[model samples]
Target: MSFIKNYIEQQTLNRRSLLLLSAYGLCGMTTAATLGSGVARAAAQNPKIAWSYRDRTNPYWNSIVSGGEAFVRSLGKSTSDLINLINEGSSEKSLSDIKSLLSRYGSEVALAADPNDMPNCRPVVEAVSRAGAYVSTIWNKTDDLHPWDFGDNYVSHMTWSDVGPSEQTARLLFDAMGGKGGVVHLGGIASNNPAIERLEGFKNALKAYPNIEFLAVQAADWDTQKANQVMSGFLTRYGDAIKGVHCASDTMAYGVIEALRAEGIEDMPIVSYDGNPQAVELVTKGKILATVFTNPHWAGGITAALAYYAATGFFKPSAEPKEHREFYGPTTLVTTKDAQVFKTKYIDTNPTYDWKDFWSLGKGQIKYRS
Candidate 1:
C-alpha cells in the first residue's frame, strides 16, 4: 500500500502552480517599482526578508512557503527577492543556512524560520539578532527564549497551541470509534513543541474515554512514509483491535490511511492535523474523521511580513505590549461537516491582503484564546 501515487503528484503540481501564480500576480508591481526611483525609496524603507523551514518534502512546509511567498509578493516585490532556504531536516543545515544568510545580507534581511530542533534554533536566533537582523520564528523553539530578551532584532515567535485542537480532534475520532476500541498515535518530530502539545491533548482526551485504549505511540518525525510503516507495524501487532488513528499532521495521516487500506481496515476512524488539501478531500469523502486546520498559508506569509515591517521601522516591536511580542496563531478544527466550507473560504479562495497589512494583524498581541 504505497501512499505515494499519481494523486500525490497531481496535488503537488497543483499546489506549485497556485504558488507560482500567486507569486507572479503579487510580484508584478514590485518589478515595476524596482525600475523607478521608488525602488530606492522602498529599499531604504523596507528590509529584505528570508524564510527557512525544516524541508520542502511535506505539504505543511509547502504551505509555510506559500504563505511566506504570498506575503513577499504582497509587498510589491517579486518573491524571488526573498531568500528561501530548506534545511533538509538537518538542524546543522538550518544553523549553517542562517549563518550564511546573516553574513551575506546582514541587517538588510529579516528572517522567519521554524527550526529543525528547538535547542539548536536558539543560537541561530541569537546570531541573527547579533547581526542586527530581525527574526520571527514559527512553530519550533525553546520555551525560555523570548523575543523581548533580544530586543527589536528578535521580533516575534508564533506557534500553534495544538493541545486544545488536538483534543477536539480526539473526541471526534473517539465518537467515530463508538467509544470503545484501541487506537494508535503517530506523532510529529519527537522534540517539536506542537508534537508535545498535541500528544498531551490526546492523552487528556483519553482520560475522558477510558474504554478506548491506546495500543501504541510512536514518533514518525512527521514523514508520511515513516508513518505508513509505523501504522503497518501497529496493525500487524494489534490486528482488528485497532479502531482509530491519531496523527499529528495530515501528511502522516495519509500514510496511516494507506496502512489501514493495506490491511483491509477501511472503517477505522482517523484524525489528523495541518488540514492539507488532500486531507480535506479525504474528510469530505468520509475517509478521514477529523483534522485541525492550522492555516499555514497565512501563518507563513504573515510572520515574515511582520518581521520585515518591524525591521524596516514600520512598527516598533518594543513599543507593543508584552503579550504581542510572542504568541500562537489561530487554529480551527475541521470536521467532515465544515471541511468543504473551510476549503472554499480559506484554502481555495487564496488570500488577498497587502504585504504590509500583516504587521497590523499582529498588533503586538497574542490572539490564541485557547
Candidate 2:
C-alpha cells in the first residue's frame, strides 16, 4: 500500500480508537495499562519514522534534517515521508511532541531525537517506552540512564566526545595567539553537553599556557545575534586585551566575526567547533584558526536507521552489547593547513553511507567522567 494512503487510514483508525477508549474509561490510563500489565509490546512492522531536534535555522540542524530525508529516501520513500518534530530549543515542547506522536501512532513509531537537553531524555524515553514505540537519541542524556534498563524500546543513544576535539581547536587558537594573551569564549547553552565539554577542553588547554590569561567566558546560547551582542559587549569591556576567541559552534563564530568586522578588527585569532561548510571555508581563508567536523549527516541518518531497524525486528536491541547501545560519534579536526582538503572530501560532497552498517562510523562506547 502507498505510505500516504496508509498514513491517512492509520490516522482515521487512531482517532476512532481513541474515541472508543475514551467512552470506555480507558483514556485516563497509560498505553501500557490500557493494553495489559507485564506484557511487552512487540516490534512494529513498517513503523512511522520521525526525527526530533532543535531547528533548521542553523546549518548543523539543516544538515541533520537533510540526512534524515536521505535515509527516508533510501527506504524507497520520498523525503516528505520523514516527520520533523522541531522543539525550537524547548525541552518541554520536545517531550510534548513525542507524546502527541505516541498518542497517534502508539506502538508503531520509530523516533530519533536529541531531546533538546540532557534531563529531557528521560521523559521522552519513558513516553515512547510506555506507548511501545522505539527511540534512538543523540547529544543529550543523563549519565544514570541506560538503554538496557528499558530494553528494546530505547533503541540507542549516540553522542560526540567534544572534550578532546574542542581541546585540539583550543590549542590551535592558543598557538595562533603566540601562546600568551587574553582570550574570551563564546559558548552554547550552559547546560548543553557539547558546551560544557568544549569549555572544559578549553580550560584543560589553558593549564600549559600560564601566560595566556583567561579573560572571561559567557553562554551565548548558540544564537548568532546573541553572540554578536555578547561579542560587542566583550569588545567594549576588553578591547585590545582580547587576543583570541574560542567559540563552541560555527554559528556563533559567524556572529563573532561580524562583531569584529563592525569594529574594523578582522585579524583576531579564533577557533570554533562544528566544521560546517562555511566554517571550513573560513578556515581555508584563515578567518577561523580551526574547527572540528562531527559528520552530522552520517549521525542523523544512522541514528534513524538504528531505531527503524530495531522497530522492524531486523536486530534485537537487548541482544546487542553496551557499546552498540551507547557510543560516540566521529570527529575530525579541520585546520587552515588542511581545511581545503577536508572540504573537498567531506563538505563538497556528502559521503554515501550504508545506513544499516550502524557502528562502522562510531568512535567507541561513550565514557563518562567520575
Candidate 3:
C-alpha cells in the first residue's frame, strides 16, 4: 500500500495543477471548480471498464492483465470492478463476448481490447462506436481503419514496431552463425500484426546475408507446444543444415529450444521478440542470442487508461492529433551483455509509469503498403 501510494505521489508532480485547470486529471482528482462537476458527472454515470483479450495461459497475456489490474487500482476501484472478457483464441467468440459486454453496460462502458486477429478489430470498432461505448485497442487493427474516423468513441490504437527490433535480433543471430548458414523461423499467428512484422524482419535480415538461407518458416500461433512440434519437424528435414533459429516470440522460442534440447543441441544461435521474463533469463544464460521487450505493463495499463480517461471527459479524443490517436508503443532489444540491467529495471522491479501520458505516446502509427 505504501509503495503504491508513494508511486502515485511520485507520478503526480505538476500534473495535479494541470488537472485543476481542465475537467481532467490522470495524476489526481479534478476539483469541482474545474469544468464545473464534470468529473463528478462522469463518476455518477459509472461506466463499466472492461479489458478483452485472448486466454490467460500465456505469460505475456498474464503480464498484460497485471497492467490492466494496476490501472483499475489507480482509478480507486477494485480489480473486480474491471471486467475481463477472455476470448480464448476464437475470433467469433471474441466478437460475441465484446458485444454482450457493450449491451450490458450500454453507453456507460469503457473497454481496452486486442482484436485477436487483424480483421476482427473492424467489427469491434463498428459495434463499440454504434453502442456509444469508448474503446482503445492494441496490436491488431487493420491499416485502412483509423481511430479518428470513429470520432471520440474510438479512443486510440497502440502497436509495437516489431520489425526494427526483430531485424536487429536476427542480425545478431546471423553474425553469431558467422554470417553463413540456414536458419528455421518459428512464427506467431499468421495474420497477426506482430507475427507478420517479426517474420518480415527475419526476411529483411536475410536479404543482407546472401550466404544465409531461410530454411523454412512455420506458424506456431504463438503457442509453445506447437512451436516445439514445428521445430522438431524442421530438425528432421533440415538436420545439420539448420544452424540457427528465429522465433516470432519468446514463448515460441522456448518450444524451439526444447525441441533442440531433445536432440542434444544446446548452443544453436536463436533470437526472438517480446522479452518475457523467462526469455530474459534465457538471454542471460546465453540460450537465446537476443529478444525485444515491448513492455506489456505499459501497453496494457495505458490502453485501458486511455479509454477510461476519454469516457470520463478528461480529454476529447477527436481534438487530439492523429499521432496521439494511433501510435506505436516503445520497444527495446535485450542481448546477453545488457540483460541483467533490463531485468533489474523492468523484470525484477517494475518501473513506475505515469500511465496518463497517452497523447504524446508511441513510436509511430501503424502503417501498411498498398
What TM-score, over all chains together, does every model reach? Answer: 0.86, 0.90, 0.87
Q: Give the winner by TM-score: 1 or 2.
A: 2
Global CA lDDT computed for model 1: 0.77
lDDT of each candidate versus the true structure: 0.77, 0.85, 0.81
For residue 171, give model 1's deviation from the true position in Å: 0.9
Which residue pairs in candidate 3 have backbone atoms (N, alpha carbon, C) closer than 3 angstroms, thus clashing? 328-363
lDDT tens readout by residue for model 1, 142-174: 877788887677888887778889999999989
- Screening candidate 1 with a backbone cut-off below 3 angstroms (N, C-alpha, C), the clashing residue pairs are 30-76, 67-301, 324-364, 324-365
Q: Tell me the alpha-carbon RMSD of every candidate.
A: 6.6, 8.8, 10.6
> After best superposition, candidate 1 residue 303: deviation in angstroms?
0.7
Clashing pairs in 2: none
Candidates, ranked, lDDT: 2, 3, 1
> lDDT winner among the candidates?
2
Candidate 1, which segments miss by more than 4 Å at Cα? Answer: 1-4, 7-46, 359-370
RMSD of 2: 8.8
